[model samples]
Every structure is written in structure tokens, then in C-alpha cells.
Target: MIERDEAAIYVDGLTKTFGSGKNAVTAVEDVSFAVAPGEVIGLLGPNGAGKTTLLKSILGLVLPDEGEVRIQGSDVYDRPQQAYEHVDAMLEGARNDYWRLTVQENLRYFAAIHGQNPAVVADRHKSLLERLDLDKKADTAVRDLSRGMKQKVSLASVLAGDVSVVFLDEPTLGLDVESSLKLQQELVRLTEERGLTLVLSSHNMDVIEEICDRVVIMSGGHIVANDTVEALIADFERQGYRITVRDIDDVVLADLRERFRMTSIEQTNRKTRFEIAADSATFYRLTDVMEHHEIDIDSIETVQPDLAEAFVELTKSSESSMKPNTIEKGDGD
Candidate 1:
């Protein structure tokens, strides 16, 4: 049996590499992090960054070549079933119900398998359907529900059971705006009211930032950033500013180019736009120079790179810096 702890999920030194020698692919490498009970963690990465592999490893769906995954306190690989007793997972397109079964029938079926009384399961099925806005479709066949409705039914199937830890892999993938918003709100409710430990993997940064308390970023099979949203954003905040001026003269433009890494500059008939990096003192010096030259300044929109942009920039830099030899090397035992 696993010991209960404040943290609901913990993965340490987890690694997974498929094949060997020439054909080997390192899917995930030395990934480690913790999700406290009642917390939501967003596993964010680009395509082929090992997000799905990490989730699969945690779910015991895929055996890792190295390291360990723990749900609550039980080692997932060691205890297997027992370790995941409290966990419930929804892969991208897993449909639990028999297609011929009605939504109500499906829930009843799963609850029965979970050892719940038929009457209680029936009540739960009704309640979940109502809560998820699936009440009208409860008697409809599983195969007939819309994609959004099917996703809801699948989620309800998991929530109806006694499981406390939920793993959602791109739960809102391809969902329309209204449906996605509803699901996102429900996910937040699960953590806030039900104290559910939710680990979500998605390519959507907005979704991740909206729901997750912490974020773990993966790139090239390695965990590049793991921290709270605020901390991660602050990590990249290195005194950047946007400057808008009434005009872009050669002297002013030359001065700016010489002082900082100017990411962008836009010149129009009435104004110029610039995204530049500079410290506080440097900002003051810049303004002082503009004033000395009788330059009229317009409004500025100082923008900082958000989590999505930061993640992209960091991973691209890391990927570009990898040596050819390293890329050529295979993942081996």
C-alpha cells in the first residue's frame, strides 16, 4: 500500500528511449517533478517533445526504461494496479462505453465494474450527466453523441467512479469555443471543489496557463523548465520594453540599434514602434537622449514575452545548440 502524502504525484529521474543504437529515439530523459494533492500541473511541449510519453509513463501505460513514477506514495511500476487505485485517466480518444450502449447504460456498466451498487450508480450517472450538461443526452446511444458530448460522457465516466487523481491528455483538443470553455471551467472546478489532482498535457498554452498551478516544459526529450507560472514568467523578464516615438529619424534609429538588441522596429507616417531590451537606467538614458534631441515621444506598449513565447524561444535555442554528434548518438542501455 502507498502512504498518503500532501503530494499526489511524484516522478523522479524518469527516462524512456525507444529502440537502441542506430535506430534509437530518446523520448524523455531524466524528467522529474511533483504535483501536490488538489493541484493542477500543465505538461507543455511542442510536437515530439515527449509530453505524451511522460503522461503514458505516469499512467503505467508505457513502461519506462529508467526512473520511477509514484501516484500518492506507491511506485507505479512496483505496485502497478495498487499505485493507480486512486487514479483515473482519459487519453486523447479513449471511449469507455460500448458504442451500442446508451450514455446512462455506459455509466451504470462502469460503476458496476467498480463494485458500486446499481441504484447508486444510476443516481450518479444522472447527476454527472446533469452537471456536465449531458442530461438531455443521457439516454442517447454513445455512438450517436456529438464529439463534444462524447468527450463529456467520457469525462463523466471517469468522474463517476471513486478515483481522485485524473490524467487528461489534450481533453479539449479540437473542441469548439463554447464546449472548450465549459470543459475548462469544469476542470478548474474539479481541483477547487473536489480536490482532484489533475495532470493535463496539451499544446495549448492558454489552456495550460488557465488551469494549471504549475507547468513542466519538455523539449527534445528533456525537461527544460518546471516551476509555477509566475516564477517561470519572471525567469524570462529581463528588462524589456516597447518604445513608441513620433518619428524614426536616422539618428534616433541608429542610437537605438547601437544600445540594445532591437527585436523589431516599425515606422509609419505618424509613429514608430520598437520592441527593445534595456535596463531601468538605460531606459532613463534613452529618454534623456530623445529629450535632448527634441524628439517627440508617442505612447509605448511595453510587452514581455509570455509563457508560450518564452517556451518557444528557450527550446529553439536549446535545439539549435545541440551538437551533431549528440544528435547522431543513439539511446542505449
Candidate 2:
């Protein structure tokens, strides 16, 4: 568990290269970030973008060639036991728990591994099962349960040891919408109630936007943007509006095109519709232009950007910023 004043997880200049020489592929390069206690950090990346390698390296499942990872103020590579004491992960929810065990049994069995007294953790086990909506399946064998139910049982087992940090890798994959929503709600509630830090890796933008305090977007094995969901959207957000005006003459249209960023123009018998990017300053400028032109005003509306747009733009920017490498044979592994 993390003590006061220290980040829950700290990664510094973490670089990992696979293979050797010309065939070597850099999964993660000079990536560094610190996650505070109780913070849910999202890993956003496309395929082959190094998100998995980074997470595994921090968790000690993959060793880094250079750089360091610290957990709870202890260097994970040098003091692994101390650093990993309170870290638990459910990378493959389907395989994390025993197939023959019931939900309650799985939780009890896992908690026992941490030397937690059955009597002491009994109440917590019940609470976890109920909160995860798995109480009804408490007595049901994991093998007999559906995939979602088994995943919930696996999650309960992983968290039953009172770990301070949780890593969930695509926890909602392949689940139905209702099941996914239920799991998401349970995750948020349990993490807040337990004050646990979480690192979530998923392709679901809605889940990331809803749960993560901040997102670290990666592309080409590099961090493109690391900020809160709101801030990221505000930074890369597309701003625009469509205006429908009556008797928008050729001269007025000409002035608008010359003055603003406009697209999607359409004109009917009496009304003209056109789209343009407008901010408060631009809106004021547009009103001034219309007044000067003696043109009748219709309606103007703004379009807000969604998380998907921000993700695309951020990833694209990262891709554009990549520097090509020239391979040279060296005497290093």
C-alpha cells in the first residue's frame, strides 16, 4: 500500500526494445508518468502502440532494458517484494479465478493467500459480491456461470486481498451492454470506497471518459497527451457552427467565406444554409459583418466534439511527431 506523500506508481524514462539489431522493435520509449493514490488513469492507444508493454513493465511481468518503476516509494526492480506487496491485477478476467470454485469460494480462497483471516475478510467478501451484483451467483460454480459472471468473480478474487492498486486490461471486452454497464458502475464504486488506484487499458472511449481522472494517450510507443478528459477535449476540440439565414445574397456569402472558416454551404429558394467554425470572438465578428452588410440573421448553432474525436486527433498528432530511426549493428543486447 502507498504511504503519504508518494505516488502510487512512478515510471521514469521506461524504454523496452524487443528482438535485436535491425529486427528490434521499440514497444515503449522514454515514457514517464506518475499516478497518484486513488486515481484512475486510462491508457489510450491503438494496436501496436505500446500500452500493453508499458503496463507489463511496470507490473514486473516484463523487464525494462532501461529506466525504472517505483511503487509505493520503493523501486520495483530493486525491491520487488515491497513494491509489489499491494499490487494486484486482473489482466485476463476469464482465467484469473478457479473454474471449479463458487464466487464466494473464489474470494475466500484468494484472500486466504494474503494471510487474511477468513472471519475478518468474510464481511468484505459478502460486500464485494453484493456490490458487484454477484451475490446471487455466490454458490454457483465459476465454470457454470456465464462469461460476465465469471469475470466478476475473478475481479472479486483479485481485489479481495485489499490491494491498493488494480490493473484492469479490457475488463469489459465481449460483454453485453447491460453487463458492461454493471461492471463499470461496480468498478467506480469499489475503487472510490476502497481508495484504490487503478490503471485501465481499454478501447472503449465511453468507459475511459467516464471513469478515468486523466488519460495518457500513446502512439508509436510514445505518450502524445496526458491530461484530464475535459482538458484533452478542450485542447483538441473541433469548434464550429451552422448558420441558416434568409436572403443570404451572393455578396453576404462572399463576405462570410472571406472572413470565417466555412464549409457545407447550401442554398434553397429563400434561405441559405452554411457551416462555419465560430468562437465567441468569431461570433461577434460575424454579427458585426452581418450588421454591416444589412443582412437578416437566422440561427447559429455550435457543435461540440466528443471523446472519439479527441482520441483520433491526439493519436494522429503523435504519429506525425515520430522521428524515423536508422538501424546500426551494436555490441548491446
Candidate 3:
């Protein structure tokens, strides 16, 4: 076995089951992957898709029913301390500091407890405060900060440690678009300037599409797809069209629905508009059907493919291939 120290994190055949008998539910099933040094890996999946459990197993926070997980050349299950010292995690709803502490105090305090030098901690505190846009309220107690601001503080504290890897779960939740972009920019800077490796799990497709070097998508407790975002998008092109028509009465609307995949229908006083999805052949068929029925044509426009559509398609595909299964609610994701 090659010790993949060159990789920041590695896993093979990782699985987690919650119970025995008919009530047993597997949260993660036979997941395997590796994160290269300094790479940003996005863990993507819909609700109850096993993404969260996989992350916990990799982080050594959950004991796997079966499999191997290694962090920075150390076996996480065998040498917990050594495996975790180089890692920082910001799981959603987790507190990295006391409520009584101020933003500056939290950073300085956590750093010191981690055995970081006081001088280095001070330097990190100043730099992070400015970069994360928390400088103005550095002295304010964390309990007083808004939810979004507190999340920023949590992310900022991760850097206070001398770790090479960071795990962030829904880092953008509760944030406005402006603050979300700020945090995203900071994440990019960390990877670019400091060669930090990040394992990010989020439902925000925009953040995943923009920041991740590679994506791992899960469904039914299994990894349905794993590849670079660009490749995945290119391979699975979305098929969509928006069309306007004249005199779309119930008969015509029913016919259209029966023949094609109509996502939405909007009817103006005289004209009707529909957003439909189809392959090239079906798209042409739709136009021909309209012409044959003598329905007046207005215009048609193409809808470009994006990550959200790709995610939906992949999950659907995974669901179709799997056997009947029921994952436990809340615990599955």
C-alpha cells in the first residue's frame, strides 16, 4: 500500500450504518476518494443523500462501520491526535469560541489553546479581521454579532491554527449575497496564497460551481458522480426551450403536456408562454406539432445548462439505478 502523504486526505470503502435488523440505515456506503494538497473539494448532494456522513467519517468525528481513512499520512482511526492536529473544521451550528468572548478575543484565545505562539496569533488576528470584514466589530462580543457575522468569525478562527486543511459545512448559510461573496473571495485566497486544502459541503450551487476544483455528488448513500465541475457540465448538457404561442386553450395545453416536458406555463391575456425541456428531436417535434395545429408562433429561446440542472439529473439517475431503500431522516445527509 502506498502511503499517500502527498494527498492531504484519503479514504477507501468508507461506510456507516446506524442500526441493525430491518431498521438499519446506511448513511454512507462504500465511498472512496482523495483530496490532493491545496485542492478544494466540494461535497454535493440533495437532501438525505449521505454527504454529511461521508464528511464526518473523513474527519474522524464518526466511526465508520467499515473502511480506511487517512489524514496527512496518519491513520485517523489509529492515531486520532496526529491526524486531527493539522485539520480545522467549521461544521454548521458549531461554536468555536465562548459566547462571552469578543471576535478578537476568540481568535487570540483559540490560537493560544492550540499552542500557537502569541506573536503569531496576534498577526493572524489583525490579518483575518481585515480580510473577513470583521475589523469594525473586533471588540464586540460574539453573542452580539449577527448570524452572518458570527459565521464569518467562525471561518476566520480556522486560520488561527497552523493547519493545512479546513472543513466548512454550508459556510454561506445565513449570509447575504455581499457577505457570501466576501467569504468566497477569502476561501480562494487561502488556497492560492497559503496552499490550504478545503473540504466544503454546501447546498449552494453557485458557491460550488465557482470555487470547487472537483465535485463529489452523492445519492442513496452512494457517490453517484465524482469529477471536475467543468467536465461534468460538458458531459451532461441541459435540454431546455422557452416558447410563446397563440390560442393555447385547455385542449392544446393538455396535448402539449402529454407530448413534451413542460416545466412551467404562463398565459398572458392573448398569448401563452411555456418553459419546456426536451432533447433536440423532441424540441423540433414540438415546433412541428404547433405548426400542424395552426397555433400561431411567437418566438423560441434556448436555456443554457447549469450546475443545478446537472445535479438534479445526476440524482435522478442515481435513484433510478438503486434498489428500494429508505435512509433515516436528518441523519442521511
lDDT of each: 0.77, 0.81, 0.84
* Model 1 per-residue lDDT tens digits across residues 291-329: 887887877666766777567766777688653322313
Residue 277, candidate 3: how far off, in angstroms? 4.2
**Residue-wise C-alpha lDDT for candidate 2, range 95-171, written one tens digit per residue:** 88888888888888888877788789898888878877888989988999887777777778888997888888888
TM-score between candidate 1 and the true structure: 0.79
lDDT of 2: 0.81
Candidate 2: worst 10 consecutive residues by lDDT? Answer: 324-333
Residue 212, candidate 2: Cα error in Å is: 1.5
> What's the count of clashing pairs in each model shown?
0, 0, 0
Measured on C-alpha atoms, candidate 3 has an lDDT of 0.84
**Residue 73 Cα positional deviation in candidate 3, in Å, after optimal superposition:** 1.5
Better of 1 and 3 by lDDT: 3
TM-score attained by model 3: 0.92
Number of the predicted model whose lDDT against the real structure is largest: 3
Q: For this target, which candidate reaches the highest TM-score against the unseen true structure? A: 3
Q: What TM-score goes with each of the models? A: 0.79, 0.77, 0.92
lDDT of 3 by residue, 122-189 (tens): 87689889988999999999999999889888888878777788999999989999989988898898
lDDT of 1: 0.77
Model 1: CA > 4 A from native: 1-6, 93-97, 121-124, 238-299, 323-333
